[model samples]
Target chain A: MIVKDAVCPFCGCLCDDIEVEVEEGRVVAVTNACELGTTKFMGEKRMKNPILRVGDEWKDITYDEAVKYAADMLLAAERPLLYGWSGTHGEAQCVGVHMAELIHGVIDNTSSVCHGPSILAIQEVGHPGCTLGVVKNRADLVIYWGSNPIDAHPRHLSRYTRYAEGFFLENAFRDRKVIVVDVRKTESANIADEFIKIRPGGDYAVLSALRAIVQGKADTIPRTVAGVTREQLVRVANLCKSAKFGAVYFGLGLTMTQGKYKNIRNAIELVSELSRHTKFTISAMRGHYNVYGSNEVNTWMTGYPFGIDFSRGIAFYNPGETTAVDILARKECDAALIVGSDPAAHFPRKCLEHLAEIPVVQLDPYPNATTAFCNVQIPVAVTGIDAEGTAYRMDGVPIRTRRVLSSDYLSDEEVLARMYALMQEARER
Target chain B: MKVTLAMKPAAKWFIPIEAESIVPKNFLSGTDLRVWRGNRELRLDEVFSVSVEGDADRAEDVEVVLSGDTFRLKRVGEYLDAGKITVLGGIGMHCGNFMSGGTIEIHGNADGWLGREMAGGTIVCRGDAADYCASGYRGGRKGMKGGTVEVFGRAGDFLAESLAGGTVIVHGDAGDMTGAEMRGGTLVVHGDCSRPAANMKDGSCYVYGTARGMIPTFKKIGTVQHDGRTLIRFSGDLANRGKGNLFVKGYEYLD
Candidate 1:
């Protein structure tokens, strides 16, 4: 036995066409999964080992005891925040939102730091976007900006951009003019026919100059401008303008830099301007598979995309006001329930400073940086591995996450339901 | 009419909504417009008619406060000739982009890409700015044309690239490769810089920092400078024949 349709929730790709063979309630073999996915499938699954912090050290406790303590801490807190949900199921995400509402706490996703800029750009100017399938099949000009997919998304080029054969684009890399723009030279850049190195934070500036030349503007300087000259600028612009179909892909290099949000804003605006010439679009290289799904669901339900705050009982949004980073850094929150993300490793130095001060609860499969600092740690089954759910790919395509292995641990949804029940019980008491 | 954009905090996300434009009665003591969503989208000619007018006392109390919580607007077009919009606190990404007319100024540090794919506009930053201040996006090529960005503080990487037109001036140190694959544009860096400087076949960069190892692909050319500072130039990114030139001077970094 195996599931014909399985999904891999290892990264933002959320590849849904996975086949698995299970034996003895465990996955024996998996097909169409990336390296990270394979590691996830064969990894160790521990027991209910919920740990509690007494004063300094941690002690393993029963699930019931841990759950009870978690409930108590949450109930006692004045402003409790629930963050993260990328690796969890949609059902669990719904439960987490409800919990935040009942507690009048702030609820934020991983977007507070990582791809928050991309989300903001989308809200400003709607995205002219398509799925990966569209890129493989139709895109003739592929441009990677501030990202090295070879390291991050290993199979991106082989499966879609450079290797795979689509209906329309039979010749993959040969037909496509690969261009890599980044701060440092990367492996992906090595393969690109044209590797244009822009100064860090200079992407916005460089793009402006190129657009100026494309529109037929003349400017002369005795020396080079940021290492580039006038003739090459015109040629690159010509390549973009002549392409039948083009795609601009970028990653954290843009968002993580000093110009985090501005990077994505310019990227989107660039794609928008490219569309004026021919057919051009762009996609953010999202890290978590279900992040796009969460954004989609949250957007449809609420007018705002992410970093939501429910302090007034009803939904009121001010991204700067509701952003998790600001709330945590300012020490406005007292307690927190973190889901799938590992903020200890990813968040800035200032953000982690405040997170350490709160009474934190973590729901994760493994012991990550955030879990190590939490007061209560509850283990949960990894979505698409031990639990099945629906998630969205980086391109905003929803796919069914399949369950191949069985687990004794609680699902994220189950844990959330239990917490909600405990909260309701306390209110009635 | 003054347009007020505001966002409210919900449990999971922030809700952003643009308010209907309203005409203000006062031409002085500029009206305050708040953005609930970190990003506020204003159509061309929407806020060009309004101005911040006669509020010496009010200006002292709150120097153009645009709070994220309250959705308010200040109109002073009746008393002033030009409209001035000054953001008091930190703003979301693309704070000022694609403005054909009028001036939009940010007082605090702004997120990435200052004047994104700008056609016409004047944007000035009082604080540091993030990457891609006035560059083109990935893939389609063609960047800023007919606009200007002046960063008074330090700037993040990729100051400008894939540029077709525009002038960018950084008063402080800039991140790696001031301009990479730029086609056309003028960039002036008044501080230190990092590597792989520029890969463009076109455009001009004036750096005051030490020039590092030039890509084996780029050919050594000449040198030039403004205000008495010397700068070395090289034509490079032979990967594209780019005829693009890179200028660096002072600490001798040519590799």
Candidate 2:
């Protein structure tokens, strides 16, 4: 049977037009989704039961025992870390926050590594952004700065910016312009009308020069700014000004560069400057499907987007200090609960060293890199496949992911609810 | 009163202690106070061997001296409106956060966010200072609104980021994005710095040494004499308001 309108729980695009053919409780084929989303829909080798590490090997454990053990460990810990909610649904993320507040611990998400810098920049200069639908409808000029959507978010162009049918344009594909800015020529750059290659860590300098050019200070700018000629800068500035509506989408390449958040701030300020002449907007090309949801929930519930510390019984936020990477690397957390995302695959070696020392509990479907560090690993249903919940898109649009198949395994929300229930029980005592 | 806190050895050296209440005014109330190790709150005496040298009537008369592995202690003088704090060795992150008045002296190296958001008083770091020194909190519009921060040694990245109103002086080479987004302030770097006074609207940044990767927008406005040295003055970052002044003895661009 084909399940229609299932959200692909992969990239931040959160494509909801997926058609999944499931037979005998497993996904056999998928359509209307990218290669990355198709792979997640047809995932394999899911653990049947929860396992605990005894000495050097694994020991099968009941769900009740696992939940109780996780609760007891968190209750006893002085500084616990609840991390990795980006891969899960919003319901599970809600429970995670309450647990952190109750346990007096730190709660952070995958954004700390990806678009956290973008948020920092937005806080400083304020974001001037619009939804993906708005960009597809009205934007005549689309700039993919420091991002290669062709390789990462494969359907981004076909769905929204470059190839998507525009509502206002006479000829959507013919009239819309595409520009790719990066340190190197990427696959996405191949299709762009303009591909401006830059020097490594030169994004900040380049951005500053463009801002000056936009402000009519072109004469003050040097002949070349960060490998881009003054002529090219002026041309780009003119293109932005001439366009009726422009949209900019940036990725990790800009945020993780030398200046980090300052680069995004400059970009936003540039957009603000260009807005005086034409309509413009800027948005982050978020990585995970639900990472934006994590930020949304955390912000509304705790006032901060991520890297929140409840150690003082009130939510105290400081990103660099309370973030997961800094917490693990500094050996601040004695116990850790990892839900949905893998830290061992991404975290630095220093953080892995502390992960090895701490007692860790993880809730995931497959045995990923983080499984190696977990003393207790519990299997759960994957969102949009056997489980369904709300997920926020890259542009902050909420879509309720539809379930495609039946599964014996519990969902992330069910598993976390069990843990939170036990925690509440222990707290009342 | 002179309060002395000598840190005691801990089983876990990695877990830091937060003693934001260690300021002189808090001590004027009584010897009783609280500090945090992770989520666990402990008596001030639990982490340190506390002693009172004398009695005082006002906050200005009280001074706090910290010794022994104080590098792991954080927020030593937060919200310090007055008084003085002296760290014998290296100090930790947020040594004097949001301090409106008083003085903090660190003999050894200081960590990130040293003297952060200090509205008044002075902080003298005899050793090298880490990132975000004399800067604002994350997402705060203004930093170091009014105060003085002097680092006798080298400093790290984003030094005095978003500096609004204050004076910061560094004797050795400073790091990237110095005086970034500074709207009102005076910054002096005795040695070289990268991308000094970036995106600043209104302020004065002086680099006695070479300025590397000079932003392209700042317009050259001839030369001027500053403190017996003939420096090149530029009116920028023209990218923004183009009102800020940048003075550099020498400069280089990535061009």
Candidate 3:
């Protein structure tokens, strides 16, 4: 049986035109999906049973026992930190927020590590953002700053930025001017019309120079700012100013480097400033498939998007403080309820030590590093594969993840709901 | 009177307590304050053991000491006009956000957004600080308008970003962007930095240690003497016609 027009829940693109062929409850092939999406849809590897760590020994436990243990641990802890909803569905995240509120714990998502500064910058300067379709249709000038869409978002250039035929742009690649700006020459830079190599950590400077040049203050700019010559700056500025519509897609390179939020803020301000001459929009190239969903759900439920703390029985947002890294590094939380994120693999050494010290209960479809380090692990059905839920694209467009195959395992939302019910019962008692 | 708020172990929750209402200036000996835990309001006494000692008639004369992990307390001394507030343990985010005048000392580590958009104050963090220290609030153009933020230990990324005025000094290593897009201010980093003063329009950055790279926008001028130390001075965030100056102490020019 072939599932037509299925959403690929692997990256922020959230490509919904995928066709998955299922053979007896297993994904046999995935068409119209990138390699990464194919791997995700094909069920590369998955955990089938619930596991519990007893005295440093891994023991296979029933789902009921795992859920009970997870609930008890969360309810008993004075301070509990619930992290990671990026890989799951919005339904699961909503339940996770409720659970965090009910348990009076901190709930943070993957945005804290990646695109966090971009979110902060968006909140500061305001995002002149648009959907991928707009970029595909109207954007004549597409710039990729500190992002490599070729390796990260495989079909981004072909589907949205460069090659896709649109209403206004019939010869997409031929008509649009593709500019790639990065510290080093990346794969995407090789194919761009202009590749501007910038010094690492000089994004803010380069962006400021661009802003200056675009605003007709080119004479004041240095001969070479961030390794781009005066002529290059003038040309690029003129191109941006003259373009009917332009779009900039940024990635982790800007957020992870020095000047993190300021870099993104400068980029946003540049896009905003360019509005005087032309139409331009900026978007962060989100990594995780549903990470955008995580931020959106958290923002709607809690005023703040990420790093929400409910320790005092009120929702409080302060990124660095309530963030998972800081919370774990401080060893303030006694227990943790992690969902669909591997902190053990990604967190700093000090944070991982603290995470190991605490009792962690994880809900994931796979047995990854976090599950390995966790005390209780409950297996869940993968969304867009064996489970169905709503997911948000990078541009805040909601798409329903269709389950192509039926699984005996429970979904993340179901598991979380069960845990919430058990915790409520414990509290009532 | 010196006010002390000691946390009780049983008073743990995920929803952070907004304790800005419990500023020293607003508190009397027997006065009570209400803090929010999520949407619910709780008496300050219910969460912390509050006690007042020592006499004070003015906000500046009052000293407030908060003792606990305080990792869940948001905006502890927000908009503090005047007073001295100290955190005994690790503090949550926005410890001294938008404070016009005050002294906030954290004996332990502090989370992000410390002294955000502070107009005037002195913030001292004994331990490490998370990201966005001494930065503007979301959508705010200026950051740390006037204040002195001294971090004894390391600081996370985006330190003193979009700084408009005042001074920020880090005794230990800083993560990245020591002073990014700074319009006017003085940022001093004693330890190594990834990058300092990117897109700064008008300001001064002093790095006592190493910086990974210098933006081409800044022109290298001759050395200058400051506090008995010879430093390499560079002017211009020239990208935006900036006249910012960056001084790297103990930096030797490689031929």
Candidate 4:
């Protein structure tokens, strides 16, 4: 059986035109999905049952025991952390938020490590963004700033900005122009009509120079601003102003750099300055497939996007303090519950040192890096592969991911729901 | 009236204690206040040995003195409208948030978000101050609206960020992005800082030492004498409204 138009559960692109061929109960082949998506779809190394750490060894545990153990641990904790919702569906994320509220814990997602700064910047100056389809069909100029689409989002350039045929332009290839800006030349930069190489940790300065040039104060700018010649800056400003519609897509390079969100803010402010002459929009090149969905769910439910603290029985949102990395590094949270994503691989050493001391429970299909720190690891079904759920694209559109194959393994929603139910029952008792 | 509260050594000192109720107005009535250690709410006496010297009917007449292991104590004087708070040792994060009045004097080092969004007050920190000192909240447009924050020692990054109005004086060096997005404020850094007043809309920033990565947007407008020191004056950040004034003794551009 072939499942047509299956959403790829990989990057934030959420390409919904994937064709998955399943034989019996397993996926045999996938078409139209990128290698990253294909690898996840055809992957078969899945943990079958729950495992418990018995001192130096591991012991197989039933789902009921695992659920009970997780509930008990969270209930006894003074400050519990519910992390990793970016890889899961929105339904599971909702349950995770409820669990945090019930336990009066902190709930954060993968965004805290990635595009959390983008949200911070957006909060300062409102986002001027458009859907991917709009940029694909309408934009005559696309700027990939601090983002390399060729490596990360493999299909982002071909499907949305650079290679996609536009409705407004008669000759899409001839009329459209592409510019890539990075600290180093990337594969995406190789194909750009213009590539501006900047000094490392100099994005903020470069962005401010552009904004000044756009505001007709070019004389104030230095001869060379952060390795880019002033003449090049003025030329880029002119190109932006001359373009009928331009779109900017940035990645972690800008959000996780030295200046962090301030860089993104400066970029957005530049886009606002450009809007006075031409139509301009800026968006983040989100990594995780449902990371945007996680932000969306967290924002709608908790009034804040990510890194929320419910320890005081009120929703307190502060990224630097309540985030998982900071909380773990500060040795603040007593216990942690990881789902969807892994922190052991990405987090700093100080955070992992504290993670090793805490009682942790994780819900993931496969045993990843974070499993090494967990006392109990529950195997769950993968969303968008065998379990159907709602996900959000990078452009803030909700896409319903369809299951290409059926499996007996429980989904994240089921496991988290069971944990939340047990916790609620214990609270009532 | 004088109130002295000494901290009790906790089994878990790493977990911060939120004590926003320690303001002078809240203590005007009595010491019947609540504080939170993680998720557990405890009485004022549970975390501190409270002692009152005399009775006071008004908030201004009351004086609260905190001593001992107060580094992990957060939100000490939030929304403090009057009175005085003196920390003998290092104070925790959010020391004087949104304070419209009063004086906070910390003898030792201070943590992050010191005097955050403080509208009107005087915060005197004799020791070093951490990141976000006298800055705004996450994504807030205005930081220290109307207050005087005098840090005797060095300050961390993003000091007085989004400073809309008020005066901030650092006797020592400040970290990166000092007075960023400043609209209306007078910032004086006795020592060097990087990228002073980047993207500021309106304000006057005086850096007695070198300004590293001097933003390219500011236009030099001759030299001026300020506080008995001759400094080069510049009008910027042209990236924004270009109304802010920046004065630096020496500067280096990240050309």
Q: State which candidate, 1 or 3, has the greater DockQ.
A: 3
lDDT tens digits by residue: candidate 4, A252-282:
8899988788899999999999999999999
CAPRI-style class, candidate 2: medium
Error of 4 at A343 (Å): 0.7
User: Interface root mean square deviation for model 3, in Å?
Assistant: 5.8
Interface RMSD of each: 11.6, 1.1, 5.8, 1.0
* Global lDDT scores for all candidate models: 0.67, 0.92, 0.85, 0.93
Model 1 docking tier (incorrect/acceptable/medium/high) = incorrect
Ranking by DockQ: 4, 2, 3, 1
Question: Given candidate 2, what's the lDDT at residue A11?
Answer: 94
DockQ of each: 0.04, 0.77, 0.27, 0.78
Clashing pairs in 2: B119-B146, B145-B165
Question: If both were scored by TM-score, which would come out higher, candidate 1 or candidate 4?
Answer: 4
TM-score of chain B of each: 0.68, 0.98, 0.92, 0.98
Q: What local lDDT does model 4 show for residue A102?
A: 93
Model 1: per-residue Cα lDDT at residue A236: 81
Instruction: Return the TM-score for each candidate structure.
Output: 0.65, 0.99, 0.83, 0.98
Model 4 TM-score, 2 decimals:
0.98
For candidate 1, what is the lDDT?
A: 0.67
